[model samples]
Target: MFLAWQEIKKNKLRFTLITGILMLVSYLVFFLSGLATGLASLNREAVDKWQASAIILTDESDKSLYQSSMSIEQLNDIKAKKTAVIGQLNAIASNDDDKQNISLFGINKEEFLMPNVTQGRAFEKANEVIADESLKDKGFKLGDTLSLSSSDQQLTIVGFTDHARFNAAPVLYANLATFHQVKFGEAADQKKDQINGIVVRDDSISKLTQNDELDSIEIESFIQSLPGYTEQKLTLNFMIYFLFGISSIIVAIFLYVLTVQKISMFGVMKAQGISSTYLSWSVVAQTFILAFIGTTLGFAFTLVSGAFLPAAVPVSFDLTLMMFYGLILMVVATAGAVFSVLTIVRIDPLKAIGG
Candidate 1:
């Protein structure tokens, strides 16, 4: 191990160059991982806030919530203690100077799915709306008024909630009556109540089985059907895994060339009574030291960038996921060292030293 450190110190330029490349690759991986996680959060945060075991969507919509419609009477057929009838739609909400796309959610304030308000108070009336905190970026604040383009109505921003985005758009929580009026243009006397779906409690799964018109899929499965959610996740995951494969190849090629360059030196060391096992262990230790330093630097950059980045760029990296990624990097780097160890093992001390 001492000899390996000594060699790295002596070959400072070569090692430094390789280390810089490793650092950049790792930084790319970490940044992309955070972005992917943040995007998925935008898709699922609203439903995830409910913590429901399953969601019931009408079978007629072909497993799509946006296309499914259920009447209030049909929703009453579900026996869950915490059933929440939900309606989702997309519309543009504009203030005097700005307009932003929003995913509107109609939820009963008393239901379990209502997110906790971060500012002001929750909506309790037909014309009031609670918005995701993300809207603060678009010049909205509590007590502000927003007009929806699809209806001749104005909604007061009563409150703001955190982490309530849906399908990459800020979510607006409104009363069921307001949603019906804005979505269907139906008057109160018409009695045409419709909802996208219902989220049910975990223990009520058996009770819901009796209904054949609704299909109970896990909340995650329902989220997967959201537009662009599944496709974006798959594309990001493929890039992350591809980056991992590139790291392995990069480390392996660098170490193999370094090993080949030092074949004669290894042979001389073996002829001078140095053990092959010690040489192999040193190779692994070198790999660990370099990989550890490089990945640590990359994550440091991620943290610093998070601090300075504007609020709009989502950076929600889970600790467990980051730890798993670091582990994978170290393992692949160590595996690359094994090739150098093989080269050391094959050194012919007698032939090389002219014995």
Candidate 2:
């Protein structure tokens, strides 16, 4: 460690440049991670808030919430500690000249799936609704009436709830009756009790996995089934893994070049009685030190940059996830230093010094 520190001190500019590159690479990884997480949360934030274990939809719905349709009687067959009926549809909510796309959800105000009102009281009557706070950006607020493009009916925003977005759109939560009215219009009464799916909690999920009539899927799987969700997640993860590879290569190349430049010095140290093992450890120590400093600074940069980002830009910084990545980076950096360590171990004192 002392030797590593001394070498870094002697080549401050060179080491600083190397550390800067690592820091930038780490920052890019962390920032992309935040964006990926934020996008995922936006796609499933409403469902996640339910804290349910599984969702039950008709077997033919292909695990899609929007495509599923079933009668309310299906709930009786589902034995769970907690269950909630849900109705969903896509619609544009417009107020005067302003308009926004949204996922309209129907749930009983009394159900556990109902979001807690953050700005006003929860909806208590038909046609009254609580919406995701994100709608506020589009000039929606308490008591504002929004017209649904799907039907002639309109709804009043009774309150706003935080983190209630779905599929990257704000959600409007209303009673099942209102949802039926909007979804079926003049035939509303005919499908008053129809539902998209059932959100279930605290049950042995495996029990319903093989049902002939319904598809029961874990919440995580349900989230992944969202349109384009799996593809988006896979793409971002590939980028992160690619960056990890690049990080390893960058560290290896820097350390290898530095080691080659100082071969004569290392030969002298070996001749003076330093063991190859000690010299190799010094290389590993240097890699760790540089990685630690770079990763920490990169994390700090991510936080500071996140703070300045606009609310419209989806970015959620999960500290635990970022920390795990940071640790992985450090490990990769150490792995990269192996080549340098091997070079140090193989140095022939006479040949190196004579050269």
Q: 21-100, model 2: which lDDT tens digit per residue? A: 99999999999899999999999999889999999999999999999999988888887888899999999999886899
Question: Which has the greatest TM-score?
Answer: 2
Q: Please state the error at residue 139 of candidate 2 in Å.
A: 2.2
Question: Model 2: runs farther than 4 Å from truth?
Answer: 208-211
Which RMSD does model 1 reach against the true structure? 1.8
Error of 2 at 96 (Å): 1.8
Error of 2 at 234 (Å): 1.6
Q: For candidate 1, write residues 1-355 as lDDT tens digits.
A: 7977888899989888777767887888888889899889988887787888888888888777788887777776777767888888889999887899998888787888788999999887888999999899899988888888888778899999998887778999998888877787746447347788888886657557457888888777788988888899899888988888787788888988998888888889999899999999998888877888788888788778877877778777776787688778777877878778898998898866667
| Candidate 2 collision pairs | none
Global CA lDDT of candidate 2, please?
0.92
